[model samples]
Target: MTDGGAMLPWLVIRQDDNGNRYRVGSYATQDEAQRIADSLGGRGPERLYWVERMGQAAPS
Candidate 1:
């Protein structure tokens, strides 16, 4: 987690070959997660949020 809520953990949502959500992933850095989320590039139209992993350890 980051102070001032500037940068925090995040889950990079992705789908499997069959088009199903896979396991929820947590990242130490938000930048890394953002990259994964960016790869998704929005499917047609969907709501998304860039959030931190609750009760998860912050970047060391």
Candidate 2:
């Protein structure tokens, strides 16, 4: 469970040719995660996603 003041964890994910999503790294902010994901240009398809904390609703 996360308190109102807590910052959620963000993950930088990349998809392999087999379409399996793998975590590149965890970050404290979405911007940080995005920067890392963007830095992997031409490496593969990637995106930033929020890691759902306990008691938090999943993103629709």
Candidate 3:
């Protein structure tokens, strides 16, 4: 858990066609979130998708 008392294991970042980025959801593990992101391939040039850790500012 993080300082906020919430689980900070994994996070999914997704971008919409309108150039808006946001957190899609959280996962118990990084691998779990990575699998979901991989399955959502080719979001398009206007869209972005990636997985990251809760406290991380960028995907590693």
Q: Kindly state the number of residue pairs that clash in model 3.
A: 0
- In angstroms, the error of model 1 at 16 is 15
lDDT (Cα, tens digit) per residue for candidate 3, span 1-60:
453676658888888788677887788888888888887757666667799886778733
Give the CA lDDT, 0 to 100, for residue 26 in model 3.
81
Flag clash pairs in model 2: none
Query: Which digits, one per residue and each the tens of the lDDT, describe model 1 over residues 7-60?
Result: 545666544445555434666677887776676556544434343465544332
The residue pairs found clashing in candidate 3 are: none
Is candidate 2 or 3 superior in TM-score? Answer: 3
* Residue 18 lDDT, candidate 1, scale 0-100: 55
Count clashing pairs, candidate 1: 2
Q: For residues 1-60, could you state the per-residue lDDT of candidate 2 as single tens digits?
A: 123666547666565656565666666776776777677746634543344322445444
Error of 3 at 56 (Å): 1.1
C-alpha displacement of 23 in model 2, angstroms? 0.7
lDDT of 2 at 24: 65
Best by lDDT: 3
Please list the C-alpha lDDT of all candidates, in the order they appear.
Answer: 0.55, 0.56, 0.76
lDDT of 2 at 46: 50
What's each prediction's TM-score? 0.38, 0.57, 0.66
Question: By TM-score, how accurate is candidate 2?
Answer: 0.57
